[model samples]
Target: MTLGLIGRNAGRLLVPLIFIFGFYIVVHGHITPGGGFQGGAVIATGVALLLVSYYYRDCLERFIPITNFKLVESAGLMLYICTALAGIVVGSGLLFNWLNASGGLFGHPVAYGVNPGDLFTAGTIPILNFAIGIEVFGALSVVTLIMFAGLQEKTQQEEDAEAAESAAPLVSKRKKGKGGRK
Candidate 1:
């Protein structure tokens, strides 16, 4: 059985907040202690919590489809690769920080010493951060969901087997007179 009502309700409330925190970590990765990988892991944990709080069939079919996760994972990887190739296309080295201090999107000069952070100053780092975040979130969530599904299936199979075994009639191994067959 899945988590009870209280756990489900708590998970419902917490999932959105967890996702928001994950995004925040990804967005501020260049200046903050957390980044895409960390944020994605957090998001995956939230997904796992939600998954565990509900029936696998109910949740898997209605919310977390494996196909969707696969698509998201692929898309994130493509985005990351494309972003890196963009630099190469512009005659810069692969994964180069050409956007830094270029007076363009996500381009801004940073002060030499410690100072307030600027969200737009990290160039391709933030983009990479987001890409990696999406990839990791999808990958981890899918893994967890699939693992849970497998466990559920195994449990159901075992329960069915037990029930069948119990329902089957018992057979006598010995005759009434074992020493002398009747």
Candidate 2:
């Protein structure tokens, strides 16, 4: 069940924008302050919006297919691990910047003095950020889906009824024996 028409419409409009912002944060993580974890959180928030805006079944049919989330998470983890290992194998040590100042991918030689932001100079950092973003997004989205999906949200009346039932005094069902002494 959707929150309402306004919520549904807003979610429809904003989900895509949220995804774009998340991707932006992930891609520019090396240069900007936002990084993989932050980006992944943002993306998960987008998924959350969809969940609250629509039913889980609707979301699965219209927005996302949950089966692939684990694969995405695994792929992200493997990419991160492989990248780190590649540093040890190809470069000097673990997590070493394999393309630093080498005139290749992200290898532009940074000037000695104050330098403007260079997108291609950060190299492996960007790759790591991407991997982390993918992993986090998948994991968090799956968690959110599992927690909320297919569960009936209790209405206010239902909650009140439940509370009243629990609060009511207990009464004996069995008949009293020997002048209610037993």
Among the numbered candidates, top TM-score falls to 1
Alpha-carbon RMSD, each predicted model? 9.3, 11.0
Worst 10 residues of 1 by lDDT: 173-182
The deviation in Å at residue 76 for candidate 2 is 0.7
Q: Give TM per candidate.
A: 0.81, 0.77
Off by over 4 Å in 1: 153-182
Predicted candidate 2 versus true structure: per-residue lDDT over 35-138, tens digit per residue: 99999999999989988887666446445677688788899999999999999999999999887887898888776656667888777988999999999999
Candidate 1, residues 36-137, lDDT tens digits: the string is: 899999989888887777666755557758889889899889999999999998746899988888889898888888988898997899999999999999
Q: Report every candidate's CA lDDT.
A: 0.82, 0.82
Give the worst 10-residue stretch by lDDT in candidate 2: 173-182
Q: How many angstroms is residue 145 displaced in model 2 relative to the true structure, after the best TM-score fit? A: 0.6
